[model samples]
Target: MNSSDGGTATPAASGAPRSGPRASYPAEQSAGSRRRWFVGLSVLVVVVGVALAWLGYTKFATPDVAGEATAYEILNPSTVSVQLTVTRKDPSEPAVCVVRGRSKDGDETGRREILIPGGTQTQIGMRTEVTTSKPPVIGEVFGCTMNVPPYLTQPAT
Candidate 1:
């Protein structure tokens, strides 16, 4: 049979495939795909960066000395004595201690302040002879503001 009459086909081309609408992708589509991929990669990188930043800030950020305070009472008062202990996280700073007392009438009876070096505990002890003929109810409140330096806040090895 003749070739023009649909005889057995022979190999036509050589090194590369033929170029056509179905064989090759459009230039615009290829460029758009690349841009979309780049945008997706950029978004992923930004998300990862933000997550890492949040973790770093939460973990390594300095302790915010916003304010830490606690109150407690000592029972069975004979000779009323107030004691305060302050410890500094850093060795360069100083610890502050204060002792105060309040009477049954809600009056400031006594107060004392002391300072101790950093990385050390300082205690302030005070003794006051209080007479409560009418069943005394002595109230004491300790208030302090502390700022821990950065050097002493190193993470444990």
Candidate 2:
């Protein structure tokens, strides 16, 4: 085509060459792309959240069974004879049992290790004067696995 000034103005070809700014994709297409990206991000967040919750539940919800052993008074200090019992159930291999008693002021008055099988009950006997000004409180009575040989080996079968 020719302008009035006789300057040639080329017409855009059928496979048109763009003039000025190129046309943008339609609003619906851009919005759909954004929606898809958001949905993907949301799905990723949900998956990560569920995984973290499962981990937290497994880690924190389970109770610790390692420190379950306890001590009970077989005899008070007034008697000339005293007997104590320590029971361990389903203990790990090579377990060490420790029994500690504390005074009212939180002092370690006495401690002893009772010998017993891993999944059995053992009894310990002690005789001491009941001369403490304050009654004793059993502080800790628990068993833990130790990596040492038993002081008194069990008799051969």
Which candidate's TM-score is highest?
A: 2
Clash count, one per candidate: 0, 0
Q: Lowest summed lDDT over 10 consecutive residues: which window, candidate 2? A: 78-87
Candidate 1 lDDT:
0.46
Compute the lDDT of residue 110 as modeled in candidate 1. Answer: 55
**Candidate 2 clash pair list:** none
lDDT score at residue 154, model 1, on the 0-100 scale? 49
Q: Which residue pairs clash in candidate 1?
A: none
lDDT of 1 by residue, 12-93 (tens): 1343443434344443557888999999999999999999999999988763211121333434442244333333345355
**Alpha carbon lDDT at 133, candidate 2:** 30
For model 2, state the Cα shift of residue 67 in Å. Answer: 4.2
lDDT, model 1, position 153? 50
- TM-scores of the candidates are 0.31, 0.38
